[model samples]
Target: MLKGLARIWFCWSFPTMLKGLARIWFSRLTPNSIDTFKELSAQFASYFIRGYKYKKSTTCLISIKQWEDEVLRSYIAHFNKEALLIDEADNKILVAAFTNGLWKDKFLFSLYKNDPKTMADVLYRATKYMNADDALLAHEEKPKKRER
Candidate 1:
């Protein structure tokens, strides 16, 4: 389905292409999109927990919880955009990644960009684990099980 759309999009003229892409991608701020984002975030969280045994994985583990939270918050904020100063290119990349279901690839590529230090720095900067004294977690009530 997406491949066919991608092929068609590839053949579109520049003006039409931007318009089509904007309508298809940036307009997805619905509940389904939120759920999809959450699922994608959990998938990334699981990646850090997979015991990949690589130095990068270990570094990610150090701030895994915070990173996941920030990612979710940032994504949602991008959708809402009340007053946050988010980068347009970053948002476009995010929307494109979400539209294509390439969450992991897009996220890691955006943050890390093939630089291990950059990845570590961004993670560290956003992480709260280092400041345990100021860290507080919201207690979310679990969703009730559906009656059969």
Candidate 2:
């Protein structure tokens, strides 16, 4: 998957995933910059969803495919699962560990109950734009009841 991620870098003409990661890095800033953060979220949404389904698509899937061709397919013939976790104090720090792999370990976790830890689910819930965790970490906030 690292290779897939790498290809996205090239496809998007970015040397690195800095733009996407920046949302996590410099989230503390003036309100003017929040719009930029939303753009970043839209930019990377493809990477998580159907990036390869349409033409153009910011070429995110191209990056993923490129990585699949060069590294992932060769390194990990089998697509495995992995776990991801976030630091309690700082939810931005993502922690990943290996659980399984194919010929070689491509992913860090296996697909099972004891699979590697995951933070994507939780992260999605917490973030408002790309890295908005302020509301998420607020446990004291009351939830609105759904209409019956």
Candidate 3:
């Protein structure tokens, strides 16, 4: 059963799932979209906090895949159920951010989550402090320099 689910999750349909998630992220947070910033921020904060609280403890930095996988697995173990408190949009955003291979030195909880405002502040700080490679377009690969 797990193998079947894995096969489906890793199949060609995965891209579609990512795309759908992206749409949700954009629609919820983008200016002039349906949801207000406060509403979207609240929704995002809800998930971000849950994910952070449930984040695995580690002395060393781990890959984004490891971070997310650990969080999901931990959720399943603790709750004895599937699906985390976070929505797919939050999951995709975190996965997309981490999968880009930037910010491997930092954990997801590095961002503040005391409240929605602090959380937004952390996100703002991230945009200003993190390198473009770390914060920008997850799907677009940075061009590699040619060796001399």
Give the winner by TM-score: 3
Candidate 3: TM-score?
0.18
User: lDDT for model 1, on a 0 to 1 scale?
Assistant: 0.38
**Ranking 1 against 3 by TM-score, winner:** 3
In terms of lDDT, which candidate is stronger, 1 or 2?
A: 1
* 1-148 per-residue lDDT for model 1 (tens digits): 2467775564454225344324443344353443343564574456446733222221222222223335543543343332122222243333333323223534446544533243234435334332432343333445689999
Please provide, for model 2 over 1-148, each residue's C-alpha lDDT reduced to its tens digit, 9 standing for 90 to 100. 2367776565456324455334444343344453443575675574446533212222221122223244433322221111111113222222121111222322322223334245454333323222333445575588789999
lDDT score for residue 93 of model 2: 24
Question: Using lDDT as the measure, which candidate wins?
Answer: 3
lDDT for model 2, please.
0.34
Put down candidate 3 lDDT per residue, 39-112, tens digits, no spaces.
65576677556644333322111233333345423422332221232333243344333334333444334442
List the candidate 3 regions with Cα displacement exceeding 4 Å.
1-117, 132-148
lDDT of each: 0.38, 0.34, 0.41
**Ranking of predictions according to TM-score:** 3, 1, 2
lDDT of 3: 0.41
> TM-score for every candidate vs. truth?
0.16, 0.15, 0.18
Ranking by lDDT: 3, 1, 2
lDDT of 3 at 14: 33
Error of 1 at 92 (Å): 26
